[model samples]
Target chain A: MAKPKIATTSLAGCFGCHMSLLDIDERILELVELVEFDKSPVDDIKNFTGRCAIGLVEGGCCNEHNVDVLREFRRHCDILISVGDCATMGGIPALRNTVPLRECLDEAFVNGPSVHNPDGKYPDDPEIPLILDKVYPAHEVVKIDYFLPGCPPTADTLWEALVALLNDKPVELPYQLVKYD
Target chain B: MSQSVMFMIDGVQVEGRAGQSILEAAGEAGVYIPRLCYKEGLSPHGSCRVCTVMVNGRPMSACTSPISLGMIVENDSPRVAQLRRDLIEMLFVAGNHFCMFCEKSGDCELQALAYRFGITAPKYPYMFPKREVDASHPDIFIDRNRCILCGRCVRASKELDGKNVFQFVGRSAEKRIAVNGEALADTDAAVTDAAADACPVGAILKKGVGYVVPVGKREYDDKPIGSDIEAKRPAAGS
Candidate 1:
């Protein structure tokens, strides 16, 4: 049987979830044997080379770029898993949802206590990706097959879920493995 | 003289005191009924609805409903667990409960309940309502964003502490816990007030004491909530 291809991306996230993935320790060796990596930061692949069986997304859509990347992943992967609080429900970024977009921009750039942009300058360059009105979970933009919730799902949880998928068995979520924070 | 009430909870015969709530009897029997608005020593508010149970084929809040002789109660079933999960999800979406950044993450009862139910994602849409954080109090601050509206603080202030400093303001979507028609800083509330300790979420916090306990070391971090009550099971079996 062909090895399953897995793709991962960190969009509008702190990459803590990816760090947790590496926390799988010796299990990475087993993971490599069970699946092939494609279009992931782990392999430094900038774009998808072929269809993937699983796409592990680690953040919500905060910008147009993230939305495009998520849509691309949706088209190329058979199953897409939201892998953290960010991907599942926008995490900290979603906190800005309650505030007006202009106020947020001002706080980040213009009127911030540390900023010296006297002219009230804002990032409007064509190279910059447009920010969405509000951060949106990955599932809102594309179909999410599963969600692994955590600031970064504990390494044990990631390992257990991956092993379960590899064996085509039900994922056993032990009490200690699942956490919201 | 107190009368003994026999009941069956999930097919396990249990004995209780007459006029005692089903939740209280179940607790004495070492069965943990997940609840948020039913704190011990406090009046049963039965607001959160996380402890919904089938009492002789009728769904009722275990905390408010009294136990009876030969009563049949259903606890720890798939349907009941799902209902609890749904209530937890509604609480998650109803407020700005960002567990990752919350100081009350590990210690939060609502978050712990959600963890107990293994809620990966809420089935409801996120309602990021604009809420305010009242830091007016000298020793405490009420973050309206995280309040689950369980009225624990109100009851605690009035019933336990006798301060009557906290009360509900507004109705329905606009409803929130307020400080006796005055700003928190202007209120008579103190840091040692039971109202501060009564909040189940991060809504009411003592100033300058956020995140004192490190992550992974706080309450409910390694174990599920109500483990203390459920832990009594082994001893009860003896």
Candidate 2:
């Protein structure tokens, strides 16, 4: 059978989850044989968009750039996967969610340790993004078909989710991953 | 850890009016079934298999299992004895465990458990995983080599402590605990009493508390699980 077209993108995250995806070792080579990498931030495949079979979205929506990137993936993919803890439950970065947005911004920029001084003595870069009032799961904004929850979903979990989706089987998750509040 | 009005231990009638664990009964009865990774005032976590005992004739962590009425528990069965020995030997081989230099030598639960099971060396070839120490916190130093990854500290940090600071990274045998995405400062954020109160080993030692508690003087080998029970306790001062 022909390989399914897969695309991947990272938003306002540290990209740890994407790195974990690539950390599949020899199985990564196996994945290379199974699916066609269409447009991935890590794969350096830019502008390739032919109706993605599986579009893996990492990180939560944190800024304008992140929102726009997610919109693009939502527009293209057939099955959108909100991958990792960030996409699933906004992850630890979402701890910022509990606090006010202005306080967070002031803490990072205005009252920061002088290094992050947003004024930059004169003008801040226009392209620089701003943090949102709250960090949210990916599904809050866009439709998500499946979620792989973890701080960074383990490589086995990432592989398993993909294989299940490709073969139309149910994804099995360990109780440890979901049992905790 | 909530107080149970009624629970059983060893098929013999015993009062489990409080949410006491199987080990509590064993300890109260002066039974000396050995255990590592279980400390008083810390939450009961079934990490170190040294605490494994025959609950209904099957091996289970005596520290974590809550006592239910009429539950048959055996701490001295041959199977549990073998399992304890095997588990203690694994812990010894995994870490240097040089007791001579350790501060909590006489009072160490890990050492006591090993002694109870008569495990000096492991039957398997020694395979010590190399680890680094993190003393980022002024009060406490983390010896990664000593951690058995029972997740008592990690769970305490997230559930009891409310910091949700630490987490486990890697997979299976390669698994090790990490702090706030490997950033030490992340632990400073949401630490509740649960993490500190629930740590079963020296992995999460109290900062500036060693001098206060002294060596032979901590909560005895048996103390109730604190906040872990508060969730289930009634409105009373239980």
**Residue-wise C-alpha lDDT for candidate 1, range B57-146, written one tens digit per residue:** 889999999999899999999999988899999988888888888888899999899888878888888888999889887889999999
The local distance difference test score of each candidate is 0.90, 0.65
- Work out the TM-score per prediction: 0.94, 0.46
Top candidate on DockQ is 1
List of chain A TM-scores, every candidate: 0.96, 0.86
Each model's DockQ? 0.78, 0.01
Segments of candidate 2 deviating more than 4 angstroms: A116-130, A175-181, B1-205, B208-238
- Clashing pairs in model 2? B3-B19, B4-B18, B4-B19, B8-B68, B8-B69, B160-B194, B161-B192, B163-B190
Tens digits of per-residue lDDT for model 2, B52-118: 7777767788888877766777765677778777877677656644343344443455655544443
Kindly report which residue pairs in candidate 1 clash with one another. Answer: none
